[model samples]
Target: MKKKNKKLEVRKPNQEVRLASNVYIILIISFYSMIGIMTLCSLMLLIGIIAFKTNNLPLFSQIKTVISTIMIIIVLMFLILYPIKNTIEPETKLEKDAFIFALNRLGLKSKCELEKLNGIIHNLKRDRLHFSSESDLYRIYLLLENGQMVDYLISLRDLKQLIKIGQKVKIRNSNLKLPISGWCSDHLSISVIDEEGKTFYKFESYEPFNNKTKLKGRKIVG
Candidate 1:
C-alpha cells in the first residue's frame, strides 16, 4: 500500500480588530484634547483680564509671560502623549463585541465571499536573493487602470499553487485594481481553465497582501 501525504497547516496571523478599539481611542483622545484646549483658552482669558485691569504692571507682565510659556508646554505635551496613549491602551471586550456586531451588520462571514474580480496577471516575479524575509520572496504584479503596475506580496510557500503569470483569471472577493483592498489570505480558491476542462485549486495562506495593507489605505468593508 502507498503512504498518504499529510497537509501542512498554516497558523492564522494575529490581526487586531482595529475598528473596534480605534473608535474608543479616538473618542478618548478627542475628549481630552478638547478639554485641554478649553482650559488653555480660560487661562489665556484670565491673563488678558489681569493685564488689562492692572495696566500691564511689571509683576503682572512677568506672570503673564510665565503662564504663556506653561501653556505652550501643555500643548506640546498633548501632541506627544495622545499618540502614545493610542498605542498603549489594550482593546477591551466591549470593543471586540462591537467589531463582531459590525461584521454581522455588514453581512460578512469569516473568510467569506465579498466580491469577484477579473483580470490578467500582467507579470510575476520572485526575488529570493535580496529579500530579508520569506514573505517578501514572491509577488504577483498586476497592471492598474492608470497604466501603472503594482506588486502584490505573497508568501513564498504558496508561490507554487497560485495563478501563473500572464494567465487570465476571475478572482473572487479580491480587487487588485484598488490601491488597497480586503483579501482573505487564509482561505484562497483559484480556478484554472484550459482546453481539457476547468480545475480548481484551494490553498491556505495565499493572498498577495500583508497587514500593512489595512493601515496604508481605505478598506472599510473588511
Candidate 2:
C-alpha cells in the first residue's frame, strides 16, 4: 500500500467581502483621526486664549499648573493620533487584512516544492514584506501603484528545499508569489523558522531589505 500525495494549498475567503470590510475599516479610522485633529486644535486655541488673557505673572505654582494642563492635553491627543500611535489599531489590522485579501485574490495556491516558492519570492520586486503572526501562516511582499498594489506569499517548508539568491530559475505558475521591487539589504542575513509548523529550516537572503515598506513610496525603518 502507498500513501497518497497531498497537494499543499493556500486558500482564502471571498475577496469582495474582504475588500468591503477594508474600506469600512479605513473610513472608520479616518473619522477618528479627524476627530483627534479637531480636538487637538480646540485645545491649542484654548491654551492660546488663556495665555493671551494673562494679566500678571503670579506664583510659580500657577505656572506649573498651567504647564501640567498643557502636557496632559497633549498626551491625551497622542492617544488617538494615528501617525505616532504605537498601539494596535483598527486601521493597522485593516492594512494586514487587505494584504491578505490581495494575496488570495492574486490566486496563490502552490502544490509545488519549497524551491519553487523561494523562486517566486525572488522574482516579484516587492517594495515591502508583509508577514502575519496572527491567523494565516504566510509571507506576502508588495508594491503600490495607482492606488492599487501587487503582492505574493511564501508557504513552503521542506528541509531539502533551499534556493540561493540570484539563482537562475524558469518561472511557471503565474500564481506564484515573489518580491522583486523591494530595496536590497545591506548585509547577508539568514532566518530559521519552524518547517510546516514543526521542524525548522534555516535560510538566508543576500543583501535583503530590512525595513517596513510604508505606503506612498517611502521606506520607514522598523
Clashes of each: 1, 13
TM-score per candidate: 0.39, 0.30
Best by TM-score: 1
- Which segments of model 2 are wrong by more than 4 Å? 1-41, 48-62, 81-156, 159-222
The top-ranked prediction according to lDDT is: 1
Model 2, range 101-143, lDDT digits (tens) per residue?
A: 4334444322221211222223323222465452322333322
Q: List, residue by residue over 90-129, the lDDT tens digit for candidate 1.
A: 2333333333333443443433234444455687667554
What lDDT score goes with residue 131 in model 1? Answer: 36
For candidate 2, give the lDDT of residue 152.
33
Q: State the lDDT at 31 in candidate 2.
A: 48
In angstroms, the error of model 2 at 5 is 45
